[model samples]
Target chain A: MTATAVRAPARRAEKPSSSPRRRISKRNFFARLSLALPAAVVVVPLLAIIVVQGIDLVTHAENLTRPGSADKFIGWGNFTRAFSDPDLLGSIRVTLTYVVAGVGLEMIIGVGIALLLNGRIPGKGVIRAVILIPMVLTPVVAGLMWRLLLDPTSGFVNYLLGVVGLGNDHAFLSDPATALPAIIMVEIWQNTPFVVIIVLAGLESLDPSPFEAAELDGARGFGLLKNVTLPMLGPVLAVVLLLRIIDAVKTFALVNTMTQGGPGTSTLTISNYVYRTGFQTFDIGYSTTLGLIVSVALLILIFPTAGRLMGLRIRRSRG
Target chain B: MKRRPAAVAVRSIVVYIFVLWCIAPIIWLVSTSLKSDVDAFSPTPVWFFIPQFENYVNAWVDGGMGQSMLISTAVGCASAILGITAGLPLAYLTTQIWPPESTGSSRATLAILLLTIVPPVLSLTPFYRALFGVGLTGNAFGLTIIHTFYAILLAVLIFRSFLVNFPREIREAALIDGLGEWRALLSTILPNVWGAMAATFVLALIQSWNEFLYALVLTNGDSQTVPVTIAGFLSFFGTNWARLTAAGVIGALPIVIFAIVVRKHMARGLSFGGVK
Candidate 1:
């Protein structure tokens, strides 16, 4: 059923070949142009920026901070400096930690909640609505709210911790040891719902015959879940993981608002590092280099995953 | 299939606990917004207090959030509009006009989608440099143009997925009646995809509204949006919990309402129609 639905459009696209070849070519030319025009409008400026920045980085000509600065050639200097910069390298490590921790927790908790919600439940609509609140709230506001909640002196979170006999003065955001963890906690709290929603959607759309067959074969509870449900959910989980990793790698707003990459740059993700470099320090050349590095990293990470997703879709369409 | 009472009871408990976990911080925010400055800052948790409605007034008036709200709304709407207008035609071209299996259009679509992975921080300086060169810095319209670029990826992805699944028979029928591809798209095809369009628009609007980095770097003073302004309150007010919480609530209010209103389309939109 799923395969056919996926293939229906592909089949239709192949059907018009009997028409006059000239007419088809004309239509295709006009259509392609229309599509390419909008794409160019968006992509051209971005490409120009990247190319210009790339040239500037290599030549060391323009100071992006000051308008109309003269160009001077400085080959590979920014890249070399960026490689040796402890802060940039440290930010990369911090970003890796955040991406791994944030995406991992969100996946586990999100899938767990999704399974729980997949069962017949009362007030499911209300529950789903409530869960989506954090996902919808502005990240800046969410970060601020967490900052308020995690305040050392008057925070509700610390108050609850004290009530439960956990130490309350941890100063989660201010202290270096606990700051990254605190930011990760807030990230998980806000984004776990996204995973829940996506996983739940997948759950709802799943084929039920396998579960029924598993039940008839004496499978129940965790056995059925592990054997029947999870196998079917593999593709959905892959897509969700891809999305979450991309989002997690871009963590900036929360860190900026809550910790300001503070207590000596412990919480500085690569994005925040780049922002500080470009805006605060005004090292436009180095910042652009850092940006390019991040872009390269993202491309390496995403290309394989995107290709896998494309393969999955094509297989579905073909089957 | 008989259900066990114990299992059902445990599930209910888990569900309610999860709901409370999701909502607790928001409840605390609202409570803080309603507390007096002294009560808000009390070392002990303030469970009960007379609701301070005046905090909303103070935040809205004195905090400059009203102007921010107006600016955010205008930016969100303008970007969503431009994004849709540009994105839909491009999606239509990729899905319907170009052959689906062809390398050209699919490659273009993939390239566009890949653009999303490029961290916005990387583009900020160049965007800043370009906008400054054009004298568009700190202008809402300039910010809108930048946002439109950001929004295009979402718009194209959602609309392309939707148009791919759109029935081809309708387009064929419209074509037999002598309509051009553009006309058929506008007249026959677009109406059928209103739900998809709405989903795309809402997603884009919420993104533009919630966006902080660009809004922070690009706009200043009167053109500042709510997120930037609220962040500003932290530096300017320095632990004024009452006004800050109130401002936070006000800043989050519009998107929250919008989210609920379009709750049904959200999962589909967020997943880029993958799950749905």
Candidate 2:
């Protein structure tokens, strides 16, 4: 059942003739277009506001506390200022590290656990239900819970450490050195289940014929997984990796609740920095500018690959 | 192939260990919630304590979590329903009317994907300003609109994935039998796509409920959602760990339970149908 669902898109690709004969008149075409109207009504205005307000804000010096500062137009000033802004650069670095480290670990740990779970295990249903908990837990609660766990004096982690004669008080979130790492650890803990769940589904849907054939030829265990299983699971892995990266880059709640991007800016992700500038400091103009820059950079960095992986058509320039 | 007892033991142990890791924090949260403030903050683990319900009461009533729960549910359901109402037709238009692989379908899907991946920060301030200008900020209405926008994006993608290969002939056949498009959709397609709609609603509801950033920025006081209210507990209670964990439990319990109940659909929806 799951295999059919997983293969539906691939099946659709092979059966273009299935949809070719659906006749439509001009009125029907308009009616079909009108089907998109409600979504468009909500999305279009918001996109317009982002573009218009973005353009207007990026050119000005509009701090909310300063009266009439919205009128101060200095074209590209915020963008130029961002180039030298140490905090912005630092945030960019922190975000990259967070995405790379957090997502990288999640993929590894998640895939390993999924592989384990895919094999026969007792009480599999109960284990699967338990795995769903962390993925669905509220991020704010996850962060706060981790904060309590990592607390210097009273945290469970510290107590655990003390039990093993590792010394109890490490001040994980308060020390700049350990703050980002602690948050990333929580990121992995909370989201690795996402990877396990999806990859387990993919594993379940695999065509077993290859495994049978390989096993008959002496391929087993690690060899079977390395040769047959991983290759078959390539597309699923790519999609999961892509999705994890997309989600991890927007890591705000974990850092916000845990450190508030503090301990001298160690855990300050791009989202937290932008939120601080826009909401806390009320630097509306520069905040918008920072947002536009980060967004454009992110699009350029991720979406081209995303579009391709998700099978969206894009014109390739011919040599 | 022979069954290896040692390897089976190792695998079971490892899997169980991972499960323990996943749920241990939640266990701590619940246990701490039932402890008194001093016991909750004990330098050592409180392995034994009489469970108390006062913190839960405090969080539910005084911390305003009861109010937040109502707001979150309303917003989540409203947005999910609105999203499906808008998104199902567009998904049908793109996948059923147009070929699933056509430029029309790809473009619509791509647009939704773009909206999905674009960081919400790009629109946060602009939305705040726009909604603030129209007197929608600090209330549930603006956040509902924002959540609904995201839900619509989510719904379109999930529904498209499900309906893309759901042979268009069913709808076409219904239409040919003197039924209008709306009636055909109502009588034929909607019935078939209830699974997709359910998945979309569940995931969208989860998304809206757990969303923190916009809820933090857009709403305050009475209109705050669960995350906003629970996070507020941090400062409001100021290291009253018992009350804090209690509020967190109150806020996170419903969706966590809902998610577990629908875990089968979650893998597909969370991946946007990348997996099944």
Candidate 3:
């Protein structure tokens, strides 16, 4: 496996006769110390803060108002409160919808475009460069740019729609019905290129022998794609899908900039909900509880997905 | 096999439509930035008119984006440097120094990767409280530290992956030639990984430049970055579309140019250095 190869260098003790004897030498000690020191300074404090705050909030609900106060203990109170809250529940639903819809649309469109451009096309280089513009633009700027075009009055979107005989009165960001979809559209526009670039890379690296054989056996058009390409592309697609889903779940900047979770909380993702609760409302205990929940949920989801992706990467490299 | 002319025409049309879709919003942004207020708000879109370069002047001067631009650049550079300083060693230690199959090194790598997976928004309040405790709230150095933490994940991953693929014979030859571990890393390994390092640094810089939540939450007043400053335009001038678009254009120009310059590295970096 490529994973084993990646780790093989470390496993091979350099000059075994020298390794054991020299491993603890002054130079080796300093190297290890250098690594340990920074890791400790950064990772230790971060973990300590998360763990301490999480435990403190769960045990002492009174710390909600004044964090680190550590007053009377109320076991499970914050967790129970979070579970019963309608807003938090709504945020979970909203985030799931956004993640599924945003990732789904991106995968479909990204792969389609990647497949189209994968052929011997003209201007492929220029098209790839232009498509990358949205990905590189600041999320805040992207949201603001969309706001300009999506503005109800004197906006290009409405003007163009009116010219085409479609109604121009729709307030894309202001109406609850259209607000979430509008945000999803922005997310797709910016991130779809990410999928394109990644999948295109995967597509390029694929071996041609299988496709050649399939063609000789009369695989054509949809049949070739269905029987030959897609199956071979499975691992790569899985990796892309997982990464996009994880990234999409953390969607905040666009929502914050464009909608502010507005039009009656239609776009309030769990991230925004946690931000509002902890900072705006200053309910530290409940917010920390919610934050812990989000962290745990993501950890569970990411561990398996990341492991599989890494395994696949190792296998691909080895092959 | 020769393709049908009809199919070829259809493919070209699809590619053109996709390219148009990708660039149209950006084109509109640039066009609006150069349009006069009246022209920008015309009932029918202004497809052709004399470009007004004064809007950029107004946005930079009147909008106070000039100061924010300087701050953003400083933070980006500072954080990227710090990220590399801390991340390179950690990555090298995990992948090259320590036994890779060892539980300690693997766990350490996992922990670092996990730090990245956790939503940054969850850490916002905690980081704010911690930084505020040390009087780091609204401080440029504090903002840089926050950005450094963010950049570390990318730096470590890219470095580790690159090192994993690096040829070991050269390192072993150097070690056999009486080179100290530190000397070997600096003299032998570092030069070889320059490509990955440069890519990591640029990616980190762009990320710091584009970061919004921390900048919005952690910095205020003179510490505000361009993204925050551009967002301020919305609240500051409710409907000044010309100036707002101008501000957006000015703010995005540097990164856009940087991205183009490093388009090759970026194509690799976007896939977490896996593709290249």
Candidate 4:
């Protein structure tokens, strides 16, 4: 426009021109172009990859048409098959059980520790950081650490068990019955502080006056906690629970590292199964459908948990 | 009040115990790394040993972590650079592009947030196949792109969080200076956000350095990174404990030291929302 303005002509009777309008237009174009760069570089590839995969899924429908390939799909039929598959069904049951047990244990232990450390605990800051170490430690590292400690041969766990005269050297990770439970235990050990942190936020948000007021009314101890304390904590607790459930449901880290979904399908969470199909079995179509199922399953569990958490928060604040 | 002191002591001891549980394994690995092969595997599980440079030396030279470290570092830097290049402007555009005071259209953030939670593994299947086709399946450059995607999502989140604090006047001033949109962003906005950009970069660096599964599946050769070096310490049949622990210590030490050094920004990055 400015280049054209110079070309257009003999209309300028003013003695001086600042060219403010020209500068502003240049700036707008520059800002828009630069700003668009960041999003373009990142999102374009992702969208491209997803689109390519989508095409692959569609084009390969025949290969996945039940008898043609091991993946067993004819377009949306794969998704329906994934839902009806007994292995997937079993995985859902197993995964839910693991989530409930693992996260439930974490909540109890985390809340207990938080309450214990709620006030004038010695080295509280150090303790708080220490408690968070598990969260920071990679699941692979934790798995390796536990693997060494739990190996029936020279593991520290066996050594400790030997010391206590409960000296049955258990092959924990390889045992079908014990494998999933062992993973749950490891998850509890690692993630309990995640619960503690959230609950600690609830605890931190507390005003001592309410507890004192409750004390004045002959409400004390468990009753005080049940009434004043727990209610105040309901929102945070809801968030914590929802967080734990989401984490637990999607949890593949410790399980993959520890068991690799072994001894049967006993340790096979939806994640591991999908991974097995895609990477280990090299069945893209089957795995995509399986992966899609896992995401849906996660969504199903997550939304209800989120709703419950929000509802619990809302209702607790009503009084 | 007097009884409370005793309670405090008890709690302190408990806290110390838990801390010990957390740190002890890593400590033991480091200690073992410092020892000779005989001392590392003693029935006593040697709690104390004089530090030696052999394990680390072997890890770097003989164990081939030097090469892997280079790959990891290069990949990390590339990812960070790519991520910030893409994320900063996108974040600014999304935040500043729209009319701020509007209703029913604040969903740019919500969309990005959803991407953050979407497991990277979900994309892995496609990435694996796609990379295989493009001959990037086991390439360092390919891994860089994957990390770049992961880092961009996170970097955008970080920048977007800070964008709330940006002086709109700076943008306005750039406009007044006759700078075009791109030039204004490059000359004015990026300079201001450099600190945040560097912070996000460091975080993404650490994340890429520590990442396992993607690297596990992606790279196969001299291209592979640090975590691969660490995992390779474990033999398929297991119980090469001495070498494995040594490798683990070697692989993790630099990152640990780096983390400790940058811990102030590190804390802010992790609990980015807690301050407000």
Candidate 5:
């Protein structure tokens, strides 16, 4: 029921007797526009800065450390360099791996857990409350805590491994092969709860009538879920999947805190690469160019699809 | 088809194990924080030890977490309030004043979504340069503005989801009865949307409090937030496991409690209202 209600409200025709209402609405445009002005004031300037400075910075090969470098305009220099930059290519590959593997596992495991929780479980409330911890734990703390746990020496994971005769001193974060996978594991551990919470809510709010009808028709178990439940859940699942992808693409803190995109840049995501360029390297021109390319590519990739999935009718010409 | 008793038992066990996976690290973190520095880093696990309360005291005082906590709270509250102040009216305009299905409403909402989709990395340098030019960097002022900017984006989306289906005739009636649009929102709509507002405030507050990237870039020294402060402990107290864990616990404790208190509203807010 809520699934449909979330769509645009039905359009109703105006009655002639509501002339006063019409007058108010006509004047209400500017009044209503005024209501949104404050948000515009805060947002527009930042957006303007992004565009104005982005163009200015992208055209110049200005290194912050070099004096009088701001006027050294090199048109398309940064963009051209970025295309051949091996680190940028490698970072993109790493980011894709993170988003795909991390989000994929999260969705599957999260949906499974949510489905399990929806069934008859003991202390359901307490179970739910406990699971929320990982989701809300400060990312930096989560990263550091996981780092401590996964530490090669004096770490509980190694201790457990020793007990199982798997060898105690496994350097998870320091090893290049294991480093990205380890970060992705931490990513799954932290964010899977997000998927569970949202998907569980979606499950709980699902209309009961379809299930009743499916049961009456002798549908049961996986068949029932595969047919009745999942079809009805398509929209919610799409939204959840979209959100997870968007967030996972912006993964920085966990990677930064856990490995600092190290273990030979095995886990260097786009954000980490940008931070490295802009702050660590002090290459302002290249950093802004990278930011613009990634931003534009991301929007081109997801913005229209996100709008449609959210049921917003976006026109090409409008805001 | 009802599940067999054995299947039911297995299912329950699977759920328990999942919960265990989720909670074990947190338990380890807390337990390690209570151990002595040597015990925390013992090559072998220390199953028994006297608890150390001084670690908390040390993390709180010596680590500058206390000061950072104040900075975080002030920034979080200021950003959340500013976000809601700007966001609610914009949500109202898109969902209530304009027909939600109309071109204008869709356009407005799409603009908000576009802003939401644009990664912060794109704007980070520009914002840093702009704010630094005005001497707003290295303090709470610039960071608060950026956080408020994001909070507004969050607030607008969440509020729009809640208010889109709210009946508009009530507001129209109030307008006809001589309540101005602002007055109508305050009297007629605001009362109904306290839940959304609370959800917005809590979520926005959490976002700002937990935010690290911008905080790291924009602020330093006394203005650092919880994440920055706790992260700084890593370099400052490299081998002091107990102190570091204590700092971690201190930093994560409040937000964990707040989230549990408001978990019911979190699904909607976190999903940007997709679930609701």
Candidate 6:
């Protein structure tokens, strides 16, 4: 590296008449062949797996072959089955409640972090990194870690509450009443970083000129934030909200890990419901049809947002 | 100056509180993992104690976390490599095989993006039945195949950014030189876009490493990875804290290391097109 750096300047010094041989190595066909084959070998199979899976999924179309398995045309058989099945329905309800509440909470918390962290603070980079702890951990780990720390008896949350002279330690996750709240608490702890990062990116993109103008126009701190900063951050906020909503809809590992759809189907989300119905019960065909229905239903909402963002993204990659 | 000092302190203090809230749970997890079984379940709770290393060892050795970790590492790393390589060329094809700035690119990109948003669970039935029909389930290759499907979507999204700005004239001229498309892609294209490829690889690593739902669903017990083992630990032990914490910590280590390395790529992957 040192030799190369030293030679770089020397090479530049003589570059007014550098040799053409060095630049013409692009014609090395065998060399290109070696590299191209490896690249192709590496990439092709990975995609083939997914393409294959997709083909398998669409081609099987269980409802078509196996009548009375799920439903006709796969509209809502899986969904209706899920809705009627107490466990699956419970999971769906839990998932809906959590997605709405959890995402709503995340938006507030995330936007707040974005506002708080934007453009100033002590050791902002370190703060940002530390703040990302929850987001970065594997979801299962996050779930299990919380389980250990929040267990009614020996968990540190109990210990902390003891120190602060709070409520009974065992009351947490001990009853059906508090189990879902406990699950939500764990999720909020685990996923809030997603909101922070998304909203932070939005806040980072805003211009300070508006703030300056607002200040000159006698806009104070809260006033500046309300009228100027919030509006500037709108597009990113929308994107963040949209992304988090879909992600929350896919909430499975956390609920599965912490509660196992448990204490009587309280924490079971729709995805977990599908897992239980299909895999656990061995009702593979029915589960497939049901899961498909849920997918199609969610697809209606997820498609437009996912498409718009991807469109914006493709434009970026191009320009 | 007086107001500024107060404002800065207020900002610092408030932000610190949130950060504390963010980290407090993780700090708690680590601390809880160190407590002995007696101390762990004690209703009174013990904050400070002689730290325990036995749990880590117990988790690694007796807990079978080591084996699960190996499986996860094998699957995660392999799938990431495969996913990125596949995604990059597809992105290249999408970019170059069609004219840039045309409706064709839009359609191609949209087609790929559609694949990304398709909920995994929705296709579970078909995929599971298909896999069973072909005897792919419980096999490592089959698991990799399942992982590659989603990871490829991620790869395409990541790889497309690099491929889009790729100079088309360079490709055109390479073609004019009697070089084949694959040859041009390898020699002329990859070297310039190595950084983006690295980013995609890192993103794939984090994603595949953290992936759980598919692994849990697809793999047989023998091939099941860390997350599945850890999540299902409850069903076996009926809520054994000692074993579960050990398993969770063991499961968390690689992902934590990967997260620190690829934190920036995460910014790209998650933001997707938001950040240029």
lDDT of 5 by residue, B126-160 (tens): 88788888999999999999999999999998988
lDDT of each: 0.83, 0.87, 0.79, 0.67, 0.87, 0.69
List where candidate 1 sits over 4 angstroms from the true fold: A1-18, A21-28, A61-70, A314-319
My TM-score estimates for the predictions, one after another, are: 0.94, 0.95, 0.93, 0.79, 0.95, 0.83
Worst 10 residues of 3 chain A by lDDT: A8-17
Lowest summed lDDT window (length 10), candidate 4 chain A: A8-17
Better of 2 and 3 by lDDT: 2
TM-score of chain B of each: 0.96, 0.97, 0.94, 0.87, 0.97, 0.91
Q: How many clashes (backbone N, Cα, C below 3 Å) per candidate?
A: 3, 0, 0, 11, 0, 5
B1-276, model 6: which lDDT tens digit per residue?
A: 014767778878888998998888777667767878777667775768998889888777776778778888888788888777667667776665444344545565676666666667776765665666688788666677777766777777766656666667798688668777777888788888676766677767667767777788778666878888887777776656766776777787666766666666566557664653
Better of 3 and 6 by TM-score: 3
Superposition error at A175 for model 4 (Å) = 1.6
Runs off by more than 4 Å, candidate 2: A1-24, A312-319
DockQ for all candidate structures vs. native: 0.56, 0.56, 0.54, 0.31, 0.58, 0.32
* Candidate 3 TM-score, true structure as reference: 0.93
Best by DockQ: 5
TM-score of 1: 0.94
Superposed by TM-score, candidate 5 places the C-alpha of residue B174 at a distance from the truth, in angstroms, of: 0.8
Scored on chain A only, each candidate's TM-score is 0.90, 0.90, 0.88, 0.78, 0.91, 0.73
DockQ of 5: 0.58
In candidate 3, the residue pairs with backbone N, CA or C atoms under 3 Å apart (3 or more residues apart, or in different chains) clash, namely none
Which digits, one per residue and each the tens of the lDDT, describe model 5 over residues A1-319?
3334335443532231266566566666567678989899999888898888888889998788998898999999899999999998899899999999999999999998888777777788998899999988889999999999998999999999999999999999999999999999999999998888888988888878899899999998899989988887777788889989988998889998999999888989999998889889889889989988998999999998998877721111011
Off-target runs (Cα >4 Å) in candidate 5 are A1-18, A21-27, A312-319, B1-4
lDDT of 4 by residue, B41-126 (tens): 55545666677677677777777778988898899889988888888777776544432211211355555655555555567677
